[model samples]
Target: MKRGILLIAAMTANVLLSAARADEAAVRAEIVARLPESVGNIAITPDNQLIFSHHPFFSPEIRVAKLTSPTTFQPFPSAEWNTPRKGTYQYLDNVLGLRSDENGVVWIIDMGFRTNITPKLVGWNTRSDRLERIYYMPDPVTRTGSQPQDIVIDQKHRKFYIADENIGPGGDGSHAAIIIIDMDTGRARRVLDGDRSTIPEDLPITVDGKDLTVSAKDGKPSIIKVGCDGITMDVRSEWVYFAPLSGRSIYRVRVADLNDEKLTPPELSAKVERYSDKPNNGGLSIDYAGNLYLTAVESKLVGVIGADRKYSTYLSDAEMVWSDGITASADGYMYVSASQISAAAMFHGGKGENKAPYLIYRFKPLAAGYVSR
Candidate 1:
């Protein structure tokens, strides 16, 4: 009887010990940079460097910096893309999403629609400091024009899933969908075409807690606008997830179903899955451990949802305003960019000033244990 009681006591002690350690290691934060210019999205390159897309909507250059020493950032040359051969692709209209993978290649989603339908996807070799490859996710309607806004790559498979925002004039929100491209072949195909799963719901916008009305078209004022803005993927399950910028819900669809181009429209739409509710989120990224993280723009908070479906506020603080870009780093940290996009003058008829500025921040997370409430 004494031995049995001792065994039970030992088991109980182990459980308590594990729980205690987790509680001690929840999550930690450190501010990386504060800049006046806008940085829509951030991607940590395989070489352990940081690259961000600059704003002004029509900025011609993309900036690259080393985060090894976060406080001291020096710009690396981007002339590689400016060569005469690269031409028009060299200028950056708006860089919305950035990502890299095990392949050591850096991928950038340049939504050329900074003014119109100039959407494009480009890549670079961080190690060589050279432009690697580029692709135009052809429009599903014209099947010839470029159309893309965000990207989530499966490096192991060399496939990149591109989100088609389709925000051009005279365009319908129906074009919001996913595009899959095999890096090996440069071949691309439209997936989830006109699928309801990827359309934006026009979730009412509120600034300073007040409802704000904005038009989808740049010069024209109108309503009923829809476009997918953020996207990420679960490579293990071959699930590609995306969300509309003005929508309240996130959506997903299987890679296999999307890749089967042979399927008809109604047949493919059936594979679409309405994923989850990630209100006011501007971007998304999945960590190495299968946790999907989202930047809750209006809340100034970042959220993480594990494979178990348990949602947790990974990190939250007054510093996280208009959370724009989010990407996981290698050194036990997740990086975020507070672009304060909502604070942009254009977002609110230039009434709102960018007084809060913008910031890039990161935090180390406690993987398996609870650190705090």
Candidate 2:
């Protein structure tokens, strides 16, 4: 009887494992780049070259890079931009998000945190390798506690939606909002300020059998509340989707409502709609088929929300720890970066515990076409 029960349990475990593998995306993970620095975001140029953002956590050098090989990368644009002297605002500082538009424009969002510099969106032409334009975040909007992390560019309307994580110096991301930028005029405005949709829930994030929080010098964990971290646009550029890293629900608003300059903050807030329930997501992207891809941090999975609003697991694995940034490329590939932030020294001691050689994984998307915004 005991042997029969054990055999049955083994068969059940095998069945469950097979089911889990079936739920994974049809295209498997293809390693693109492996670097010692912690990678934050990813972008694929028109020429199929890979570009990545290095989050200012594990190292100070190499803000952005273009993968020249599997293990080495070249500092993008120039080395001067990555190496900033004291009080130099011209250099890139703590860049977290990046996007490659169809127009051969690579948009980079530099969060002015480490150097107290003004945050800005920089557009560089990949073909020419020239800095095309720079739009500074309005001082008034970024005045108090603004950590703009990710961006979504709407080419149809020539606008940019930036997700202001609003995490303070101490890593307390209590305040959150969305900043809208007019690409043509270089003007910016804030919307949904302190609204429920943009705000984070008073909850703790757990990952890998540990709570997602910062560890003090004394080795005690303190909960860090981050809000409004991921932002993405629909295929038609009609809806802009976003969610807080500490929250579980995804929300979106119509692009037309955002373009209306007459709408006040409260009025814009009314236009926000709760889209769907998601896991704690680090990055969000949408395909041409209106499929939303999410790097679900807490669950260590890549989630997909179809056009029908049905939620399902696209990919999941133990090695997908702290999957940070996800982007769908024009070449029918979806790329994701694993930062391993939860295991960093900040959560252990002054000594970072993150393993070296962080990786970027790419896989074929559900449908072929450029990602929406």
Q: Measured by TM-score, how close is model 2 to the native structure?
A: 0.89
What is residue 90's positional error in candidate 1, in angstroms? 4.3
Candidate 1 least-lDDT 10 residues? 364-373
lDDT of every model, 2 decimals: 0.61, 0.78
lDDT for each residue of candidate 1 in 124-168, tens digit (9 for 90 to 100): 777776778877654542232234656777654667777766654
List residue ranges in candidate 1 displaced over 4 A. Answer: 1-28, 56-93, 114-118, 138-147, 168-172, 215-226, 235-237, 308-312, 347-349, 366-373
* lDDT for position 212 in model 2: 62
Any idea what lDDT model 1 has?
0.61
Tell me, by lDDT, which candidate is best. Answer: 2
Candidate 1 lDDT score at position 240 = 76
Name the 10 consecutive residues with the lowest summed lDDT in model 2: 13-22
